[model samples]
Target: MDPLAALRRPDDPACDVYLTGTVFLDIIFTGLDAAPVRGTESWARGMGSSPGGVANMAAALARLGLRTSLAAAFGDDMYGDYCRDSLERGEGIDLSMSHTVPGWHSPVTVSMAYEGERTMVSHGHVAPPRDPALEGDRECPPRARACVASLVPGEPQEWVATAAGRGSLVFAGVGWDDSGRWDLAALPELGHCEAFLPNAAEAMRYTRTECPLRAARALAERVPLAVVTLGADGAYVADGRTGETARVPAIAVEALDTTGAGDVFTAGFLTGTLAGWPLEDRLAFAGLTAALSVQEFGGSLSAPGWPEVGAWYEGVRQYTLSPEAAAAAGQDPEALRRYAFLDALLPRCGRPGPLRRAVPTIGFRRA
Candidate 1:
């Protein structure tokens, strides 16, 4: 079954996926030798600003040639204008459903990178007032093949159910809960979602288990599909309805920045799911996409395009697979069967075009 077939019908819908969450104007400072001292300020070699949060995933999906729509609150300010223009013009994302509030300020995140790690400071107010167009009886329902959203603790998201009501597959992801409250009260909402993705830490915290695999299994029992991402170690996935499970190792890469890696993985996995690939293949593709993102700086700007995906697939398939090694590689005797789906989807060349200066990023200011 061609999951992407629905996307090709021009009369069907303009967006392949509708994503909703907090959108931040990110100012990423890279190349810091150490954290700033309490008395004195430190210096960074480079800095960049772009849309973050769910925007990261939307950008990733758009970069992969997917028609994506974003629904969120935006302030009528310079930062909001930059984010909206960048996502719409640069990344090809649709924002017609998104709202812009007057007199409200967009969120700003200042991320300092030092030795592959980062310290972020964000400032923002509570959600801005909703647009009158989206109020009462005029609420707009998203039209797409699927919908992606970040889970909010304590209640079922109205958007998730709205999309599902329209026959859109719903994918939900969770964030770090510093409150130490797992808030399993939202588990019932997972029943309305096709998948629930969370990092190992969040999964373990919510499940009260030390093992990520155990957390994944436990989550699967509640949702149709459960995927737990383990940094460096890889990912564990379980399909409750099908009783299928798989664990894929992380693709080795020198990570420059870990920002938005999880978002990129969601984009990649969503792409593979839409293509109707198997569980193992979806996990590997997600891993590869995330590995590529970390090699570059910035959040949404770091997402890999189809070219990167194609190149990685070609490089992996180049390794010679002997009968002995193939047997040890798991079900795929050739060990290359997982990537066969890319044979048709990948373009002839995945090489990127000349870099264009869309944002005036600061680099190497005289100290």
Candidate 2:
């Protein structure tokens, strides 16, 4: 089936995806040879700033040509305006479900990249006021085909339930708990969700499993679909309804920074899943998307468009046909098998034109 066919509905339903969560002004310092030592000043070879968190996923989905809408609170400040404008103008995301707080300060995060990984420090209010409807102030969330959000502690997260009640697929993810508690008690909150996605460590810690596959199965028992991302190992997914499971290996690339790779993976998965792709195809596409993202520096700004994805598919296709090239590519059999599905899909998928350039804006001062 043609992936784009699912999105040709003419009826207005607000958006293809409704993403609500934190949005951070991410100041990324890359090209660092080592992790910053405490109380020491270090120089970065490259620097960039862009929206993070839900914005990362939103921009990715929007770039993939999804009619994405973001619903979250923004501070009454320049940072907030910058984010709002960048997402709308730069990525074509809809902000109708979003709002601005009268005096809140926009959140910010400082990320230092080194050795293909990143360490970040963020400052923001927890549970920043969401759309009033999300807080039970109105009837329902803005209608969409899917709703993406994080799991909230100590609350039922009525928005997920409301969105599901209104016939939207709810894709739920969780954040890391610094307390090292690795609580699985909150897993029940996802009962109303259609899918639960978490990175490998979080999934293992929560499920008390030593492997991602076991953790994915444990999580699959709760939600209709479960996905556990294994960083360099790629991703494992299970469908509870069909009792099927699959693993897609990661694409090989010289990774620069792993900052929002997982979120980008989710966006890619969302694109294929929403478009009715097969399970293995969804995982392969998401894995390829993330592998391409880490080759760049910025967080959401580094997401690949369909054109990039198609180009990569074409490159891989040619590489596999030539014995010497395939040997040099060094892709595992599983990864090659997963990506092989793209060989046929790209021809039918329309190319995405050049991305809109992000408007330069000064970020909030970091201490």
Candidate 3:
């Protein structure tokens, strides 16, 4: 009857899933601008830190009420310390597989967004071809009802391969541009993944695809299930079983940072799958989960918990915008809310005015 007994399979009482990937300290900055005022610095705003990438995804999945086992690596430093402690203290994550790399500085990222869009500038002191290993009492995979891989760069894909090899159902979605450009080499990585969900940009950037559906197809060839996130345009899922792709409509809601919406979607899908929901229901749940995410800043914080998501799903109009409001705002009202949230949570370029000056704060910074 012990929860740990169900760590690998659904019937097991504790039914927990394990997440293995690279964990980093996300030092996110909201408003970043270095517009040259002929030697005078412009007014700047500051935003602090939050978890990112696989770590953020793990925390999100845990918040969905699953007892998750995390197998991730971070450099032995303050960043690493913070990452480890924070995840360990989460409601449902198990830290048996998390580890620390000696002496290396943990990874960090900074983002500055305007309007409804954003530009991410990152820093990676960690190099490529990394095989992150988890030690101690982590000898076995948590008997999970499902498994997910973040496939972020520096995280060896084989770790997920090992998870798949162990009779676990696998879901994969690459993280950031750091996972490297998609190519024939990435094909091998995709072979073992079950659900390959990447945004249209990531699909086009890594996997060769001229269109969103084509991206889904290319991903389908490697993995049976594929979903391509299309912002407000909604998403398309490859349905090999139905002989065509399924268009999952976007759930209407206010958006903020879209930063980790894809990760939030993946969590929703995995959670739904484990709960025995049908594929259509799974996508809708995921769609709404992501739709609500952009209404706030950061990843896990942006992702609404099940109760909040349920409220939005139940026609909670508090966050939904109106057509008249969208027209009045000259942009989607939700998008406007999202921009304001970004302004408060991230740094900004400057206030808007008739006599204008807008400088992108992110592209100038180095990753």
lDDT of each: 0.79, 0.79, 0.62
| Candidate 1 lDDT tens digits, 1-367 | 1237544754776678888777898888777899878999888877677788778899888887678988788888988988887788777788877888888899988888887789999999867656575655633556777888788676567767788888888888986765668967755567678989999989988999999999999988888889999998889899999989999877667776778999999988898887788899899888888999987777798898877777777666644345555445432434455567677767443434732222435222457
Off by over 4 Å in 2: 10-12, 126-139, 179-181, 332-334, 348-353, 356-367
Clashes of each: 1, 0, 19
Question: Number of clashing pairs, model 1?
Answer: 1
lDDT (Cα, tens digit) per residue for candidate 3, span 17-97: 777766655544444354324667545354435567677678677666667787667777776776675677534468765
Cα deviation of 56 in candidate 2 (Å)?
Answer: 0.4
Candidate 3 regions off by >4 Å?
Answer: 1-15, 31-48, 101-104, 127-137, 140-143, 151-156, 175-185, 204-209, 242-244, 314-367
Instruction: At residue 149, give the lDDT of candidate 2.
Output: 76
Q: Rate residue 326 of model 2 by lDDT.
A: 74
